[model samples]
Target: MSYTPVYFSLREFVDPAIFAARGNNCWQLLSPEILRAADWLRGIFGPITVNNSYNGGRYSESGLRRWESTVGAKYSQHKFGRALDLKFRAPVTPQQVYAHILANQADARAHGITTVEDINSTPTWLHIDCRNWADQDVPVMVKVVQP
Candidate 1:
């Protein structure tokens, strides 16, 4: 049941350096859960931007980040390809999306979204990750954390 994104391209999910080094093989670095979740978000939230560098935009660290990258925490889920920072278009905001996910826990869980960074911590973007919470004995509700 591996899921590939229909609304996104491989270049949109990785940094320019990674895309240049691994090409399409970079897809191997991204988790299927994260990929599926991204597509699901797009279907529900309309247009969303991950890494727009592929299209000459400035965003490149919104998705999978390199281990050596200093953009986030040393152990950030973005480095493990289990997370994404999405910037939504007009008619929708990150806070709104975050509220929707929190309000629809079951739906978010079904889409493999185990965590969402707190809206206050990430006011401009919605950061969702598929980090494994089973080993942590966390409850079924999507865990909201401060990045």
Candidate 2:
């Protein structure tokens, strides 16, 4: 069988410039760890929609800088393609989503999910990532209540 990519498309995971780079497409640059983490999210949450005109979910280095200026995180996982911010639609509340992930936190290792942060206090999106796994002894699923 061939290596078929799923859970996300090249465009779904990064901005157009990434695709334009061809030889260095963001899809090519994404860590398998992050991709598997995304797949795990889809497995538990049904489906996840990323970038849209409403709120951008994924990013490039530049996009990450823009988000950082707006949100104040200089070393965000998104900057490294190791994180994804998600949009939650009908029948799903951020609380529900976070709870669900927490319920299965033990399985995170199998899916490369090192962290799941609920930044639901503001625009409301789930920030999940698998970055610098060496720093984590186990998956960390926590809700960030903005001040």
| Pairs that clash in candidate 1 | none
Residue range 53-132, candidate 2, lDDT tens digits: 32453433322223334443666666666666765666776567767777776666567666666445534667667666
Tell me the number of clashing residue pairs for each predicted model: 0, 0
Clashes of 1: 0
Per-residue CA lDDT of candidate 1, range 35-126, in tens?
99998899999999999988999899999998899998999999999999999998899999999999998898888899999999998999
Q: Which portions of model 1 miss their true places by more than 4 Å?
A: 135-139
Q: Poorest 10 consecutive residues of model 1 by lDDT?
A: 132-141
Whole-model lDDT per candidate: 0.92, 0.58
Predictions: Cα RMSD each: 1.4, 4.8
Off by over 4 Å in 2: 1-5, 53-72, 120-123, 138-147
lDDT of 2: 0.58
